[model samples]
Target: MDARSRLSRAIGTPVLFCRHANRLYHRRLGLRRCNAGGVDPFDADWDNLLVLDACRYDMFERRADLPGRLERRESRASTTVEFLRANVDGRDLADTVYVTANPQLHQHRESIEARFAAVVDVWRDDGWSDEHGTVLPETVTERALRAAEEHPNKRLVVHYMQPHYPFVGADADFDGGDFTDAEADEENVWVQLLQGRLDADRSDIWECYDANLDRALPHVEEAMRELGGKTVVTADHGNMVGERAFPIPFREWGHPRGVYTPELVDVPWLVYEDGPRRAISESTPGERDAAADDVVAERLRDLGYAE
Candidate 1:
């Protein structure tokens, strides 16, 4: 955090702390939840790596119905940039193919292309849903299949944007309000949730998040079934839904960079090695579009990300 941000944390109101303090103290203190929590993705054995954006361990455990051994791993970073920076920077990734719905690929496209062999971007503005806020998981799944088939020799990374925000599940138990371009440009769903401005209860908010995952995980299962070799399912980071941070006991929401709390960084690591290939990938960032700079930024903004 900058000097100004730290000072604001020391003096902000409770609601203010809940909304902004998470971003102010953004630094990981190296606290880990498991022994293999922060292992580098490239060093891990596998063929395909499936990334679920902002998925929590407990949430995945509850909803994962795929064929794999499920375990929890501590993510190296809590936000997209940190995840990418910690895992991909300074690494050799020429044999990797990234199929992503997340906008981070476009934001850091040059750096990613520098390390990885190829990137199949599926985040088109044509797929935007006012209710879903980003490209759906199936879009990622279809492109990932083609990418894997075309680049059989390279490692494949499939990144999905879901269970993060703009929650969409068939149950439709909770109304996520409308995250239209204008609404997302103003404030994120997390801030609205923390400020009690949204139309759901705290528990409902979390349920909505889980519901969003439900909408995404089936496509993950589809990829595991189609891809060859060992496939590992994981997340860039987890979300913070009313979790309290230490030292001040302040409540937190959203996945903010620099946070080492379990809620923000602990993600599911499910191995679907039923012949699915394995590989490597992270440096942080997110959103979707036809790769326009401002349109990509708009996707990130829709996800409650400021970068």
Candidate 2:
């Protein structure tokens, strides 16, 4: 009936002294319920947008800064807020869809697979070693592109286990070198932080990461070109490498719990059209010259050109 009685009933606390005290505090602060019911500000049209799970914002930022990386049409703030709001409200954009490879969504796999039947194609890589340990090689983007082409009318949802871990295979080479155990450990920590394990030594870890980027980008580029859509690229989270001088210091590898710092939270996003304009740019004399030397160098280096 009274504020004191209501407070007691709401909190289920029998202490009059504490209840009275809290009432006084709320009165002094002039707190009031603005709305009796929860109302959503966003429309139910979010299901139309293509959602890529496990995308990190920072990684997307860094990738966008690269020389030949694709460009983005949306502002970071808009993207972040929209994504967060949609996720929180469980609203699906009418024209959009979501595709992810996170193990947590295993239960929903069948539904997702069936719902996006035309666009979604699950590729299991049998021998690829990613940050998550041993994974199937077919999960890579190259394979995803071929799958996307198979369904020309549908938008694609590609999930690649990249730069994630185990850094396996000759194709997984970083900075033209295979990673040593110590080096791999060090790099792993760096990636952990970049994906957001810890918060500090990002600069140090970034060097090794940049090299890995050099390795992974080509595959990503090829995939984007093949998809030929308004491709949005990002990571689900980032890693922390030697940030705070704290190595994983444990037998277990990959992103540990609560390591979801901003590093892991950030990701890269790019959009490119696979039409005449992109073709013209690729064929341009200047574009050809710039990409030519770099392509040859990367190929030769990967192929033991010098060795």
Task: Name the top lDDT candidate.
Answer: 1
Candidate 2 Cα errors over 4 Å, as ranges: 1-102, 107-115, 118-132, 135-139, 169-208, 242-261, 276-307
lDDT of 1 by residue, 16-79 (tens): 6543444444432334322234667767877889999898888889888888898888888787
* TM of each candidate vs. truth: 0.81, 0.44
* Candidate 1 error regions (>4 Å): 1-37, 109-114, 125-131, 170-185, 276-290
Output the number of the TM-score-best candidate: 1
Residue 170 lDDT (model 2) = 26
lDDT assessment of candidate 1: 0.71
Q: Where is the poorest 10-residue window by lDDT in model 1?
A: 27-36
Give all candidates' CA lDDT scores.
0.71, 0.36
Model 1 TM-score, all chains together: 0.81
